[model samples]
Target: MFKLAGQLASDCIVLGDFQLCTLLLMNDAQYPWFILVPRREDATEIFQLSVADRSLLMEESCLLAEKLKDAFAADKMNIAALGNVVSQLHVHHVVRYRKDHAWPAPVWGKSPAVSYTPELLNERIGKLRAVLTNGFTFAESCP
Candidate 1:
């Protein structure tokens, strides 16, 4: 069985799951940031996955990046899998804008995370749920 990292559960809103990964929306309202965590136990690196699992992860990641880029109209899409903090095999897909608070630089440690209001949070979730179709399932409730 696989359990979500404690930090991730606290920091992100559970969007839903793909075939092999659980999709999470970072609670920060500053940017449209999302994470895809493989539903594998004790795996902290992509290389740890079996060959088929690695291929599936890449497919899921690309689908997510494309959908996010179109949905957010992002100037650039930043995707990475740095597990320095949370040692879970998760990939980040951040939608960036040229005029964003930390343009031309990584979003990490640049500024404090701006949390989402109730209404905005709902809107963001709804928007994402609408676009993330074809093998994506929306979580009935967030944890």
Candidate 2:
């Protein structure tokens, strides 16, 4: 009964699914970004989920943040769940560097997204998938 929101599908690359959420890579070349979307239907806020689901979401979010930070060797990690545009229960994990274009500023609205080419996108996905599978088993098929 779960379906990905249209904006999300168009903007992110499907990484895979976990026990309670789907992992997606934000299609922006400026940063190593990822999103975790809870699979509950019609849920908008974190508290809307069952207790077990809330716990699982936190666990997954932390795991992703740790791995992404290390993999990208990022200076900092920006993780948030601001569902202002897309009213779905989703969390974002973005690896940031001190010298990045937006640097000290947030990665949103500062500049337009720089999409990845097919070859580059695949390379990024492969690296992320490797990092994820090292710790957790994916529920959906992974590349």
Candidate 3:
């Protein structure tokens, strides 16, 4: 059975699920950051996934990037799968703006993460849910 990394569970709110990944919203309100974690046990790298799963992951990542770009009117979409901290095979999709706090630099280590209030969190999730349709299923509960 697959289990979410403890760090991830503590840092993010369950957003929803795709065909092969569980979507998570990084609790930080600074940026519209999201993560897609494959529901595979003990898979620490993209190469660890089956060929079909790899392909599906790419598709899902691209779809998510596009939707987030449009939803947030982002200047850029930063997508990466660096598992240095958390070994789980998860992809990050961050919506960036030119005027954001850390524009030229990566979001990591640049500044502290600002968590959302309950109302703001719900509003952000609602915007995401509105765009992430079709193959996406919203989570029943976020907390």
Candidate 4:
């Protein structure tokens, strides 16, 4: 019964599913950001997850952070799971650089999210998919 929220579906590009979570790329082109949502219905907090699922989420988050850092050569990887907005059990992995648009500050609210052109969106997703497929066992689920 797990389903992505309407706001999430509107703002993210579906990447693929991990063993316990669905991976999504935030639609904002300003940063190399990804979100991981556990495939559990109506669970809004980390504590709501079972102990094993909590451990699995950490493992998945770490692996994704490493891969994103490698793929984008990011100076830092910001991983968080603040649910103030969507109230879903999701983790965010954002690849950051010292010279990025919102350097020295958080990316949220620094600038408006830039929408991607069709070609650019496809290219970005393809690059990410390549890295994920090479590093993990996820099959592409996004068109």
Q: What RMSD does each model have against the real structure? A: 1.2, 1.8, 1.0, 1.8
Assess each prediction's global lDDT (C-alpha) against the native.
0.92, 0.87, 0.92, 0.86
Residues 23-137, model 1: lDDT tens digits: 9989899999999999999999999999999999999999999988888899999999999999988999999999999999999999999888998898877778778768998
lDDT of 3 by residue, 33-137 (tens): 999999999999999999999999999999999999998899999999999999999999999999999997899988888999988887888788789779998
lDDT of 4 by residue, 1-143 (tens): 99998889999988878888888889998888899999999999999999999998988888888888998889999888998889989999999999999988988789999987888778777777767864354545575
In order of listing, the candidates' clash counts read 0, 0, 0, 0
lDDT by residue (33-133, candidate 2, tens digit) is 88999999998899999999999999888888888887788999999999999999899999999999999999988899999888887777777766877
Candidate 1's C-alpha runs over 4 A off are: none
TM-score of 2: 0.92
- TM-score, predicted candidate 1 vs. hidden true structure: 0.96
Model 2 lDDT, residue 123, Cα = 79
Residue pairs with backbone atoms closer than 3 Å in model 1 (clashes): none
